[model samples]
Target: MMKIVADENIPLLHNFFSDIGPIETFPGRELNAQNVGDADILLVRSVTNVDEGLLKNSNVKFVGTCTIGMDHIDTEYLQQNNIAFASAPGCNATSVVEYVVSALSSLTESNGLNLEKIRVGVVGCGNVGSRVVETLKRLGIDVCCNDPLIDQTGLVSFDEILSCDVITLHTPLTKDGPYPTHHMFNDEVLSRLKEEQILINTGRGAVVDGRALKHKLQKQPSFTAVLDVWESEPAIDIELANLVTIGTPHIAGYSLDGKVAGTEMIYQAMCRHFGLPSRHKAAQFIPSPPLSKLYFTSEAELSWSMHTAIRACYDVRHDHYALMSSLSGTEVQRSQAFDQLRKSYRPRREFSTIKVLLKNTDSSMHSQFKALGFNVKSA
Candidate 1:
């Protein structure tokens, strides 16, 4: 049997990979060359940095991360060493989208902003950004996208993105090239953001200059910032944390379905690398969701009903509150608490897990709910 060293936080490991090997679980941060030296396969999450130091002397031939981002992995070294690598791209796309929706819903409710009237600018129209655009459009909201990597015929420019009523970033972290995303929203861009705009960053933390953002927030204090990913995370800026509208511990993609799907994707990749059949399936290992169904009466407002169902599946406020409360401690303690929060994050199901019953659903309402990934049933 292949020896597989994996991050303990990865869910449903035994259910999906027990037959393939003898698995050793280690805290992602604690995984090192010493523990991984004997393994033929290595699995990790974003917390575990897979680089030359960790893999130079290890026998591990395959590496997989159960997260969407690849910034944590040293792909060049893996390629040079001929070690196979795989990452679950778009696995958590829906999870992140649901997070954005929930956050926006809460924000609009608290501020009494009309959801349909607000214009949203989505940066990085990849898996997550595209889904966000689709969701917003389905709800009859005005949305514009900006992605330099792809065709920009109908898309807006970065300058235009900054001027929108709300801006959400989903780009990967890249430091080099013609259009680098490192501090993409620096002082210049952030300075242009007006008081009415809501800024959200669920992408890489460094994509926005945290110091610049802090300065902007302190000086202006106009825009609402919702940040899930932060620069210098764990040891993130506590003062800045207090300033944002919502600050979460990078748990936007921590939904149960997304995490399980990530594991399954990597398992399949490893099987292909080893020339073995992938018999394990995500559905087989998934447990019943805590919230199975929700009912909405005909008299209920469509927006209210949708928000209720979305929150029923996953509420961003719980995560926001948890992160905010963790700041009431020493800096080191806050950092430790941040990591602990992620380690012990409660399982959250995606919107797809719940069935929505509408007492009087119109065609438009049904289409909207379906687009939002809910199972809608009409009374």
Candidate 2:
């Protein structure tokens, strides 16, 4: 039997993997040299620090993280030690894209920002960034991209992104490199930003300088932020929590489909490593419910209808604004509360899960719903 050690935080995985091996799980903080020494395979989420200290004397041969980001794992050390590892990437692209769309539409309505003329700069052209670009383009907005890795194909530079009306970051975290993203958005970078610009970060928290961000928000309170990830994470900055517009524990990729995909990917990796037959199966996703067959003849009713449909997926700005309002008195309790709230959040269906039923006639409304990822069908 393969001796496996996994992170304690993942839900429903212990039971799923129980039959495979005698697995021992440790909370990320509990992992140390003494405890991890005997394991041959290690499975983890983003929290556990898999480095030389933890694996210096271990017999670990394989590492698997059920998360999109692999910054926590020491890739150089792993390669030097001849250990193989796999991570689930692009697993939550659609889920995060839907989150961004719902939040943007809702914020436009509430903040009175005109969406038609806005320019959005998306940093990182990987899976998540590409999806956000596609959604923004479909809505007829100008979306610029900045990814050094990708060849220039309608891509813009990092300096150009600073001038955009809205900027969202989706880059991975690297502590040391020629382009170190650890604390990439420092005081100097924040000072260069337009006072009215909106910033969003769903990538690693260290990607943006938290203290600098708080200072910037203080100087220009009108500038907004939608932060799904933070610098210290569960040990997030309390005072800074009050500064940004949106706040959530790093659960941007926590959609049901994303979580399921992560599990399936890890399972497949384990199967291949152990030379075991795959027990993985595809999800039988229930088809989206059809939209209302009754036509909304009135323009007022039509707006409400569209609003409700988007809200079902998620409203990104609402959470940010709520955290901002509460962080004044609640900053000390912010991290724990944030984690609890995320753990208890109800399931949110994605845009692809919803279908639209068209009635006789309005071409504009029909086209709009179809554009929003609703499968339109004649009633």
Residue 149 displacement (Å), model 2: 2.1
**Deviation in Å, model 2, residue 196 alpha carbon:** 1.8
Give lDDT per model, in order: 0.90, 0.75
* lDDT of residue 244 for candidate 1: 88
The most accurate candidate by TM-score is 1
TM-score of each: 0.97, 0.87
For lDDT, the strongest prediction is 1
lDDT of 1 by residue, 325-352 (tens): 8998788898889999998998789888
For candidate 2, the 10 contiguous residues with the lowest summed lDDT are 286-295
Number of residue pairs clashing in candidate 2, backbone atoms closer than 3 angstroms, sequence gap of 3 or more or interchain? 6
